[model samples]
Target: MSKEMQEKTIGFDSFPVEIIHDILRYLRKADMSTLYSCIRVNRNLCKLVIPYIWNNPMPNTYSLINLEIFINLFDEKDKNLLKNQYELDIDDTYQPLFNYTSYIKVLDPRGVRRAAFYWLKNYYVQKFPYSDIYVDFKNNPIIDIIEKSLLRIILKNSSKIENLILDFAEKYQDIPSCNIFLLKELQQGGEGGESNQSEQLSHGIREITKLSIMNPSLKRFDNIQEFLDLLPTICTNIKKIKFYDLFFIEPTMELKLCNVIKSQRNLTSINLTYNIFGLISVIRHQRNSLKKLVLRYIHHNDICLFNTFDQLINLEFLEINECFPINIILEPLIRANLKLVTLKIIDIEGIEGKYDLVESIIKSSGSTLKHLSLNIYVDLIEDKLPLSKLCPNLIHLDLKVSIRVIDEDDDIDVESKKQPTIFNYIDSLKHLKNLHLEFAFYVIGYFEEFDQYINFINFPSLRFISLKDQHYSSNFFKRWFEHFSTMFNKITFYIDSESDEYYFDPLDDFVQEMNDNGLSLVYTFDGYSNFVATDRILC
Candidate 1:
């Protein structure tokens, strides 16, 4: 045997198929570079890795080539049916060898639109040689037709698709002239077009799926309600729905949306953005089965509308962001008594009884809260956010401290800085596992004092620490890093200031030392970082 063939025989070729599958699972979780390397090792490894790599393929400029191959796979009868039924024009010259669409399990229509546009540009450039074609493809109805056809075919062939995201509405909102159905002329020959397209789209999808419609910016066509109404037709069993940036037109339309949400009998997770009064109806509809809820960017006027949350009896995870008129939200939150395991509150406006509400939530759900995060301004020492006393079982905690600058001549409010700093209560949370502290300070002395408080805190159960500062040099953080022992499994330091090579160079060295010692370090300076942690680390 040749030397190369003899050596190749000693590699993973000898391993069992089950062992190879396990190795691919680990590689699937590894970085993109590692996975690419694994598939190149041998034919067996490549075959095993192809499924994992193609499951959630990253659609980019090059993806158009693969998409072209998939498009060519449509049989002669399928192409003729599309042309005759939907009035779509198909190029039949190209024939495909592989059934590429069957490998796609996670579909993103936005990515398909991007890939379609790229392919169209290249096709036009090559076709119209010697002509300056500044084509406005975004407004082209043909592009929309092509994208929908591709999506329809993939969904029809790939029965394994369990996760789907259709977020093109926002990206295509600027092109008002282009509509999904406008590309196809009426099958009967005039204007009304075929009414069975939604049915055809529905027939393509054969499995229940997790769906995310981020910013369905379809108000221009007066079709937001129509789109919402069509979701159930496409997927009979939607396990989770993440709807963001939804605009409420009127009470009647909102009622329609509420009715549509109510129809999803299997829905268990509802994440809705923009707290309109209409959302209360949705919360009321899903109250029985909903276990997780998220609402974002609520105005002061909408605060009282969420008294509907009190109805979510089975809710285990609740998150509210940018909630104004914090007073109104507190009472309902406390009254809910959800015994939630996770709670996150951010950018709360209003002061009166706000701290009391924070304390009340902890006291109410203290035993069950495994994760808690709060972002608010306060007198760290005097505010009644009793963390250590109230929460004894918190596994993850995130606190963002806001500091105000005061002139030396002005009378300092000693009430704000009465006794101990925010760190004084840290020792009380004996079960705390992960902690993130964020604060901004202008004065150097205040920064030093804050660091001193952190250095003295006793965090025995802490496995991860994230420190973010807006104004401070790396030297300040280096000194703070020296205080913690090797018990910490991961440490993150982020400074939001202009980049300085001299200051950041040492921090990089410190991060390298931490990594060498079996601890991970994420150091960012000037809004840039060397390490970017994924969802796995935080979870």
Candidate 2:
């Protein structure tokens, strides 16, 4: 061997353990399959990657398989309980290489329940192939017991759990109550009598920082109320809370949820969706630390009660979607004089005074706002929008434009007249980096005129452009590329269509031509959404 070849060979394991662990961490976040492959390279790699795989397995595709592994990890006594009571045959001789349960740091009880039900269903189908026993697996008591047992095992063994997502959708009528693994029971050694395990369980519950509850049933609110009561005592450090589809929360349950919200020490983010009401007063408690707030599909009555938003002085990011009475929601936000960093208002159409409300918000937070997304009927606004003048610091802009002509035979240049009123300010946003435009269904022919206003000379700092159009026209892209191909570093065009019969042969040719001209372009048909072309210029 040459002197260079004779030198000590360095392998991945030769690196500092922390660096190797960081690389595996990145792989776990980007691609789990790749991280799984890394584990087979060596025992050292396996040790580092196993924890990532098991840390939050329930939320991933391999949850069912992970559930089986978790079941097998139960002690011999529990294994016997499973076999005798639930008819779940476990190989008592089987043992995992590592204590997999100890690695769980994020628990989704809903996912665990779903996985357990499916596992039980599969087992029953195989056992009684000729019967319809597995058809009613959702109502099975065995599934609930298995799910509770899994949660107990995880909470008993996990060193620290950071996030908990409770998603009890409509179908989940038989969600197990929280009494099975209450902090008191865990501390008293209710099941295993292992003080060390009990201590670990308590510590894990206390460490929870993020919690999400979705589609909670009103009928089962008592069990959820019990869980919420426990959260305030044990999960004081929770920084983020999300509630979804809370359409009919009783006054008592609402109060309980508010208590949980008020108890958090440094809560910064709250996402409320689908007809949530009477929580704004509770949210005001976190006004000092709250930074991000999202309200979606809020009833008009609740929007009127959003008057306390001005008190949230620390808020920087706010998103309102499908909420009516736009002015009521924006009034308080404007009064606060907030220096917001990001704002999104989507799916609020056919409402009067929207333009003025949006304009007021822009003028209020525009100085600090860096990201803005608006879904509105642009043609209805008679005056020019002052986006460029107010939000000068903006870096990203997403606009979903809608335009319709009342008279078909008017022969008026609606596109030329109305497009500038909405987007003429684009050129003045000097700091802008990304511009995303989604055209409405009625505005199919407006892209040609829309392209005329946007070009390389006007928007110098712009690097990325994303366009979502229902109409698939190759001519528009051809003309667009001719005008601004040299300007953008990357561009993504998303062609969304309701019909599946549309062909992309012409678009394919345009992409090929762009690729030949020193630009890398990829065209992919993504099901109902149709074609997407991601183009990157090869500088």
lDDT of 2 by residue, 68-181 (tens): 557665555667778897676665565678888788888888777767766776777777888887445467667666777788788777878888887656566645667554
Model 2, poorest ten-residue lDDT window? 527-536
Could you report the Cα RMSD, in angstroms, for every candidate shown?
Answer: 6.8, 4.1
Per-residue accuracy of model 1 over 398-478 as CA lDDT, tens digit each: 877665544778565744463255666555677877787665343233544545566567766666676665555666666
Question: What is the Å distance of residue 191 in model 2 from its true position?
Answer: 10
Give candidate 1's whole-model lDDT. Answer: 0.62
Best by lDDT, which number? 2
User: Which whole-number lDDT from 0 to 100 does residue 298 have in model 2?
Assistant: 76
Residue 410 in model 1: lDDT: 56
Q: Name the top TM-score candidate.
A: 2
Count of clashes in candidate 2: 0
TM-score of each: 0.74, 0.84
Runs of candidate 2 with Cα error greater than 4 angstroms are 1-9, 14-30, 59-63, 66-77, 85-87, 124-135, 190-198, 302-304, 350-352, 379-386, 404-416, 442-448, 488-515, 518-539
